[model samples]
Target: MTDDTAVQARRREIASEHLLFKLIEYVEQRHPGLLDFLEGSLDHLGDPAHDETKDDEAVRQIARQMITGARAEIAE
Candidate 1:
């Protein structure tokens, strides 16, 4: 959560511009380092959401990472 209401609203506005940012924010809020998975997946594959040429496996990998991260979070 941002300290200033304006800043937070602005952030939400920016995040709404892309699915990637929205996903990043959602995962970061609950499972910090899991973004490493998204970064790694993107390094290997194109942005499937925006690129019609790419498959959705990268997104699936991120979802898998999220579930794993969520489990780890719950364990802690």
Candidate 2:
């Protein structure tokens, strides 16, 4: 891919993650009971839904590891 395409892709990735965090925040606010609900859901879930578009394997691996760690922490 061209440098421009790569940059745009990264921007999109960052935006997606930001949106996710914001949604989590919104859920927590709207339902204070969701602290446990969030943790429980994270524990039940595995990695991100898709790993195919992850042309950048390094970023994909990092995301997987982070998600795994978060899930483990939640379980504890």
Candidate 3:
């Protein structure tokens, strides 16, 4: 990839990670132990047998819902 493409990819990755972290923090506030559980689950990412595609999509859907709810809360 070209330098510009690589930089763009890295920027997108960072943005997604930041959004994920924010979503985790929001969930953690309401559901105390969930962040710890998610942290523990991250270790499984290195496993060859673990399939993360479905899990990742599920998380994205949930995060979108959380963002929508948070926006509504803020607008109130």
Candidate 4:
């Protein structure tokens, strides 16, 4: 891909992630403990694809942990 293409792709990725976190915040505000429930439900899905998406999966794992950490901080 061209440098411009890669930059645009990354911008879209960041925007998508921002939208996701905003949605998560909306759900948590509307449903209270529901985000925690959803996070717990995703535990079974943490399996590695063991392929090219491993890096993406790793980043997602970090995002998941970040959400958990943020919740923990809110609790404190």
Best by lDDT: 4
From the highest lDDT down, the ranking of the candidates is: 4, 1, 3, 2
lDDT tens per residue, model 2, 1-76: 5699889999998899767656655665566565555544543454443656534545445655654554454445
- Candidate 3 lDDT (Cα, 0 to 1): 0.62
lDDT of 4 at 19: 80
> Compared with the true structure, what per-residue lDDT tens digits does model 1 show for residues 1-76?
6569899888886676455545656677787776566555554553536556666676567666655655455455
Q: Considering summed lDDT, which 10 consecutive residues are worst modelled in model 4?
A: 40-49
Clashing pairs in 1: none
lDDT of each: 0.62, 0.58, 0.62, 0.70
Candidate 4 residue-wise lDDT, 10-48, digit = tens: 999889877876777767777798667766766555546
* Per-model TM values vs. the true structure: 0.34, 0.44, 0.52, 0.60
Tens-digit per-residue lDDT, 1-76, candidate 3: 5799889999998898668767866776777776456545553444233655446546655555655555454345
Error of 1 at 39 (Å): 20
Output the better candidate (1/3) by TM-score: 3
Q: Name model 2 segments beyond 4 Å from true.
A: 33-35, 41-76
What global local distance difference test value does model 2 have? Answer: 0.58
- Candidate 1 to native Cα RMSD, angstroms: 10.9
Better of 1 and 4 by lDDT: 4
Q: Which candidate comes out best when scored by TM-score?
A: 4
